[model samples]
Target: MSDRQRSDTVHYDGPAGGWGSLRGITRIFGKEWNSPAVLETLARQNKPGGFMCTSCAWTKPANHNPLEFCENGAKATLWELTTRRCTPEFFGKHTVTEMLDWTDYDLEQQGRLTHPLRYDHATDRYVPCSWDEAFAAIGRELKALHPDEAVFYSSGRASLETAYLYALFARLYGTNNLPDSSNMCHETTSVALKKVIGAPVGTCVFDDFSHCDAIFFFGQNTGSNSPRFLHPLQEAVKRGCKIVTFNPVREKGLIAMVNPQSPTEMLTGQETQISCAYLQVKPGGDIAALMGLCKHVLEKDDEAKLEDRSVLDRTFIAEHTTGFAAFEQKVRDTSWDEIEQNSGLTRRALKDAGQVYVEAERTIGIYGMGLTQQVHGFENVAMFVNLLLMKGNIGREGTGISPVRGHSNVQGQRTVGIAEKPELVPLDKLAQMYGFEPPRNKGLNTVDACEGILAGKVKAFIGLGGNFVRAIPEKEAMEEAWRRMRLTVQIATKLNRSHLINGEVAYLLPCLGRSEEDLQASGPQTVTMEDSLSCVHGSIGKRSPASEHLLSELAIVAGMAKATLPPNPNVTWDEWVGDYGKVRDRIEETYPDQFAQFNERMFTPGGFYRGNSARDRVWKTESGKAEFTAPKHLSATGFADAPGRYRLITLRSNDQFNTTVYGYSDRLRGIEGTRNVLLINPDEIKRMGLESGQMVGLETDAEDGRTRRIYGLAVTPFDLPDGAVAGYYPELNVLVPLSHHDVQSKTPASKAVPVRILV
Candidate 1:
């Protein structure tokens, strides 16, 4: 190898074997499971047997074998079920000021919080408070603020029961400030799908993988982000299905995958080839590529006299869809030059991809953050749906649009009514079911909530589960907003930067994690989760609580609600808090057809699959059909269009999930021990007159003159596309301006940032 190669390469010195290998051996010998607590939780995940997987929103069969967990899943599990503890005594020794100096990993590594802590600004320390005191203080602060002056935030990890009750409490209190993790992740998908197909969820299920003849994956890294998907990707390939990948970076999962479960492949070091074709598009070029594909499909179908072919579902389109002619004309009018320039791909490549879809009997398009974190994210998703509609892919066995959701129960939370604005049916039903007038006003979303806090319009912030302050873009602004709040309540399992932000009366209330048992008045309680595939499953905790005082999220939310809400004769909050089954009963009452047998279905393996419009080729659009939405214009922003600037894409390492770091180890990329580095193309490094391992600064092009910079970042050149660079998220989140967000989804365009590399 050349000296340049040696300098650019990352070295791993932690332990032999990649994260997967170490985890496997550890699971056998009981080496602390060597996985995240979330992974361990997933191992026990089933319809009613164990806790819900606190990782991704993807669902699986409840009858899967014992070792169904993936590497990152294990990391999530271990991180949650660690032996470390942050007790009241521990807090007494270290003030909030002192803890603020600690890194994010160090704060969380201190382990599960054993008690509720209130930040005492006078002493600059977080002191332990009894549950009664914590609830009372929260109630006092919340009740004092106008309903619209408070924001209720929910993380995807929150269960259906807690989310339902949270929505109830927020409405009863007359506030719609329901900012959640969903607003930050897949809101674009929701907006786009709803506009085009009248549904926000994916149309396909996990079983669809078996029936798919071809899978077109765009802007998603299945191996690292959604590890559970690797099995399906491998299976589809083995079944002779064509897998086409479109991404800026070539992910290992998209190339060749080695199933840890397969004996032959594991022993021989052989890997399964996943993608038949790989298209490397520029960041934020998804819409252009998709349009190009649509154009190809239209042209090919017309020439072959297949315009009204069986694959097109002409009947469904004529009966249910609107805006077809206009959209088709728009597609026809689009110039190939414009497509190539905007998508950064030649027409031949676009035609090749479209041909794969045209010839296939069933095709599935799976996308992730890559498509949703762009300026026109919602439009990109709409284009995907439009492509599916053109081919009659929706409401089918193996063909549909599948958006890989982040966070375990995010979709589930949305299903159970964790929304800023409740739909008309659910809102009216909830009001009737609870015998109270629920607020009909739309609530604040994630971005709106942050803006509210910054403006001091929101005085209290209640987060069910998540590090809201750190996860958001413009960290400094978010933290400052959090500090200005009159009260902040975090119902969490572990310590996070959010808690350390320290509101005027901040309370970090320890909650039972997914792995911890929830023994309520009736018996052991299990929470339900709705996966990305629209499968609802039960989750019961197995391990003991980190502390006896640690309450389940449902109980905490109930307690706070009881203390804050006005007296009501309609529903019994205490009864539901005492037993989670009652919460399910209420859920069934609110959404009768959806959760009719909520409790009984828990016993059924894999629970039940929710209603899917795609399976029946039923487009739920306003016209009762899937509509093709054409791009109004073609424009490319971000670093891709910024001449002499590198488009910096923020990614999560294999060892990390979201903002939680599990040690700086990226096995596939050979990165270890640190996240403060940049992955650049080697040729770009030479052209820039820079050497490997040399620290550099990344400056964003902004009019405000506020430069976002990171120091000591080693430039590790790799196989990145020209003028493109990659780095870990959250660490690089600061580089993403709050204004640089998808206009429709309000999701920060973290995947595409314009930055200039400087020595």
Candidate 2:
């Protein structure tokens, strides 16, 4: 690497979105688009009668805006619409072994895949093959394996239509091993919220921000993961909504932000102060922090009762909840010392935050992977629910739990039946509709599927979308075991590392991106996606596809199903492929309550919301009331005993989305030309006798009888709390043991991997 391109920090002290954001947008747009025609397509993003933004799951406004996309959203759009193509010739020139040494950014930069390619063992290269031939080979292998031995994985990028068909195809094949992107991220939210609030999805909509008195953010980075969310935060701040943030690092976006779309602010360089209070909590300390807050609320209620005043919503508690006594007792039994030690926050700080919660008439609690990707992630989510239940924050217009989901349709994928847990979906209804007995046995999640592969139990792997191998934990182990599978199929838009990590009979099926037009035999087809807010909307592409050979995700899945299964009278794969409305009609038949008038609602302006019952105080649980659960431990991560070890948080860069690295630099953090550097507290660096920019190594403290380490890492000084170090994800996923995950959710504890630095 050149000296100019070497890993180093360039200090940035400005707000997140402003002139800096404009420059980044221009750079990416110029590099990706060759003509101004692409702007028309870009303008339609997240707007009425257009495509959904393929970046984050942030919702679109009820009213229309000219340019609705943010910086990272534009990057994702342009990245998909790039003119560059990875053709058959390109694959012929490079063998899989040679490309293994390339960086992830370089691999994707090679551009979109244009043709169906199959791995040839003799040549050790991917050779172009006809779609029909590829599907036949996949069917043969899938037919050879036991139903439980095949893992059908889906990425979050797929539309609800595609996800529905994918799920149906898998179940018809006699298995329910439908692990998806949610398993690695927000599965904890779904599992915990369902057990407590009797609903798995967030209850807030865009309008909720306008009505909210305050918004409490826990471990969610609005700037990097979901930049478009800053607009609502900006508007909420302007309207006097108190925005309080609790995170390990003081992220720039949550502190203050300047809306780039506002002309007056953009020209005058005016910035809006976002957070009224910013609390720098320790990594994996959210559970303790929440407990402290609940304890403070209880104490405040006690004092209020003496004066005939009430801080707690006693009426709501009596009418709408259960287990309050048990939850309150658990909080009372906890001591301040334990809270402070585990949370790494003073009692006063927790009390102050609790006071804010106590005073606000309507408040929303928002969190991200930081809270969900922990060892006790279920407890972290449940504690947040308990805090909200104390104040009756749920089942209201502007007050609820909002787990800010990553990926555009991760929640939608789950809603459409892409789940490993059999009970989560309507198996009986599916069986009745499809004329086949659906699998009732529990299926394998992401971690379990990978374990199955390692144990030589799983024989085939198929992904509808996403770079599965690169995005999951225990990647190195998975890559080695992946080769042992009899079949592996990836339905993707671009070439990724997962394509190179091929099995013996692997096929890469190129599919249409969200922005590309899907011209079916019936006509131009519009697919639908459910946003983070549970609002279902239609996405119709205007731009032509990247290549003629590429097929729609719907077509690819339908073709695979047709080729794999015998001619069943119940399934009309050809008809569904010809007209997407047939697929929607079937979805409505399968999930009538959620998808009633699915086709008619597709035309509604800004789409429609699948109502959350918890918002209406309607509990779907067995007890017929919202319940609060107590945690046995205060710390979210089970690493309190491992003193002196740094809790490593695997985060995303501003220039990236999920696991896709767009560039070498993280402009938000002022880091240039590298993703391999570590961000640690300056005090922690000094205490360990390590200087800034020193090369070091990190080894896992998991002690799982296996060696997991990464070397040649540069240490950079950051302003995070002590005992917490941050690094880019996937790079550090190696140090996180596969078994180190929440037992309830099975989400890999990527946020709290206990590691020791080596000099």
Query: lDDT of each structure?
Result: 0.79, 0.87
Worst 10 residues of 2 by lDDT: 1-10
TM for candidate 2 is: 0.98
Candidate 2 off by > 4 Å: 1-11
* Worst ten in a row by lDDT for model 1: 1-10
Backbone clashes in model 1: 21
Give a tens-digit lDDT track for model 2, residues 529-610.
9889988889999888889998999999988888888888889998999999999998898888888999999856766988
Give candidate 1's TM-score.
0.94
Residue 78 local lDDT, model 1? 67
TM-scores of the candidates are 0.94, 0.98
The true-structure Cα RMSD of candidate 1 reads: 3.4
